[model samples]
Target: MAQELNQLEDASIVKELQRRLNEKSASLLEMEQMTRRLLSLNEQIRHTETIKSEFISLIKTEFRTPISSLLQESQQLVENIGNTDVVATGSHLHQQLLRIDFHMKNIFAAAELEAGETRNAYVKVRLESLIEDALAILQYVVKQKQLRIESTIDLPEGTLVTDAGKMQLVLMNLLSNACEYSYGGDTIRIRGTVEGDRILVSVEDPGEGIPEEHLEHIFQKFYQYHSGKTRLQKGLGLGLNVARGLVDLLGGSVHCTSAPGGKSTVFTVSLPLKDDREVKDTSDGGNDFMFEAF
Candidate 1:
């Protein structure tokens, strides 16, 4: 009787062990299948990302050259329209073309900057002349907006080695911001000076001051400070970000200041000057032009 009971106990133990082993094996198989599925999904995601990147590159290569050509043609059209006798409609068409060309160039520049292809080639430029040129470009736009844009520049007429075109764009971006944020009959002031080895330019607008919370992120890409949906304040929110990037490319720094109830905001840029010889450009072998009368 004792031997039979011991045999029964051994059999039951063996059955229990086999049952636990079977359960563990099934769990291991399920876990393996899940891991394999996860890895396959990860590979698919990587493949999709690769395809998107290639598509963007292809689009850029196919579109960049034609866009450049269109911009050039539009510029020529503007010049021709100015010189030739044209009706009001022709003049309006020319202006519209110029506006489209400007937007296209901005898009191109932004793409170049994003692709890490922005080149900084500096040359000796008359600082005052550059400012005057930028101001002239904005004069018509400001007038259309019915905004008063004024500049107070108190700097020695001097030359600086910088990317003149980029500088002009920087000024235009800031001026555009001022105009875009201001109401009709609003006052916008642009002021600058040569302080030490740097030239500082500032644009102040008395429209709506940026809130404190937004100030920290104002330079971020695609950031708009206002919540009101008004025509006066609309953009891709790219101007300031691109301006900051361009300024940094030129070895300069841009900053902003704002206060609550101040009802105005200021953007300031400080750029270093190059050497003195480049400042005083001698056109011929004759005497060097005075450096203080740029």
Candidate 2:
């Protein structure tokens, strides 16, 4: 009877040891899963932080130009309030304000695009008028650079059924890029024509053309070609990307070609011709009259 009881106690001890071993194994497995989850969360946090940093840098650089222009013009207007040329000063201030407005719109549009909102409100607009309006807004930059603009328009019926605001943005970016890169005495050519069911607009500049390798990537967001330690131009590298995005939303295509030795570059945007019968009013009814400065 004593031997049998001793054997039963030994069996109980072995069972308890097995139970404790199983519990330890489960705990280790749980810990491993938790560690993996923590690692994944850390990686996600790092990615979010990186994107936030980049966005802040982009806004700072893009806003600098317009804000500086506004401050300078405002100060000038205040100083010349009592002068006979106050009218001219006010005009300059108005232009600067327009510049600020343009940049603000770009920032909002970019954010929308990033959020997968590419739909635009279409309207019947004249391509010539849009081009002229863009040129007028860029007149200060043209005068500052002493650059001459030569424009030729040959559209079918001189009308386009599209988003006038988006088209203006596209034209502004292309023209601004041309003006910024070209020499003081250089000539920038803008030509628009209609062929079949498509309209083609080209902006050409005799500036330091893009390298062959960089041409294809120029439309990428935040992509800027670095030729040396110092950049050949100053920009937030968002213009081309925004232009491409707007053009794509309009069911259009944009292409770039450069001369050998980076001597000249031309950007062309092709859009579908608007059919009057299929046109519908898509204006937001907001007074964008400020954009029609011309």
Candidate 3:
């Protein structure tokens, strides 16, 4: 009787161990399936982003030809015409064509920055002058919106080591965003200062501020905000993301602040300051994008 009881007890122990092992095996299998699904989703997202980048590139390349032709024709008409009326009409058309061209280029640049395809050709650049140039680019938008542009630069006038073109691109996008979100007759204040070894620049616009929840994701690519009230602006939502990406590439960081009324947004970018001896001046005398003749 004792021998029979020992055999039964051993069998029960083995059964319990087998059951635990089966449970663990099932759990591991489920976890593996979930990991596989997540990877598949990630691959799909990457594929979609690639498709978007390619599509935007194609549009930019194709659109430039017609836009350039239109601009040239308008320019010729303005110069060749003797009538004031005809010249004025030609000028209007020219400005519209230019705006369209610039916006398209912005779209292309935004996509390139996001895709990590933007080529950086860093050279000696005048940091102060670059800020001025960027302000000039958005001068037209500011005038159109009747917003005041107040700027202060504390950087020394010399050769600054950085990517001139890329810096200009970042400035253009930030200024463009400021203008877009700002109300007409609002004031856009831009301030630049040196904090230790970093160049801190901030653009403040008292327009419609971003909501607290949306502020965290504002830098994400293609993030559209809709409150079921009305469409705020027409955009591919690539501007801020592109700006952040370029800033990051330039060894910088960006942050934002939105008010409770959701009517003001302030963006700040901090970049590592290069030695003043390496800075070079690239100013075009005056704001290039501002049209004083008009």
Best by TM-score: 2
lDDT of 3 by residue, 29-109 (tens): 999999999999999999888868865664565466547767676776867687656766665555556556556556766
Candidate 1, after superposition: displacement of residue 28 in Å?
Answer: 18
Candidate 2 residue lDDT tens string, 1-294: 999999999999999999999999999999999999999999999977876687678677666766787787778778877888878767776776766666666666677678776555666778888888888877767877788999988775636777777889899989988887777778999999878888899999987788788888999876766454223235666788988988997899999999745478899999998766645454555323223323
Residues 52-90 of candidate 1: C-alpha lDDT, one tens digit per residue: 665456446435644565566566667677655435435
Query: Which candidate, 1 or 2, has the higher TM-score?
Result: 2
lDDT (C-alpha) at residue 107 in model 2: 67
* Candidate number that wins on lDDT, 1 or 2: 2
Total clashing residue pairs per candidate?
A: 1, 0, 11
Task: Evaluate model 2: give its lDDT.
Answer: 0.77
Q: Once model 3 is optimally superposed onto the true structure by TM-score, how far is the C-alpha of residue 267 displaced, in angstroms?
A: 1.2
* Candidate 2 residue runs with Cα over 4 Å from true position: 1-55, 61-69, 226-233, 260-262, 282-294
Q: Who is ahead in lDDT, 2 or 3? A: 2
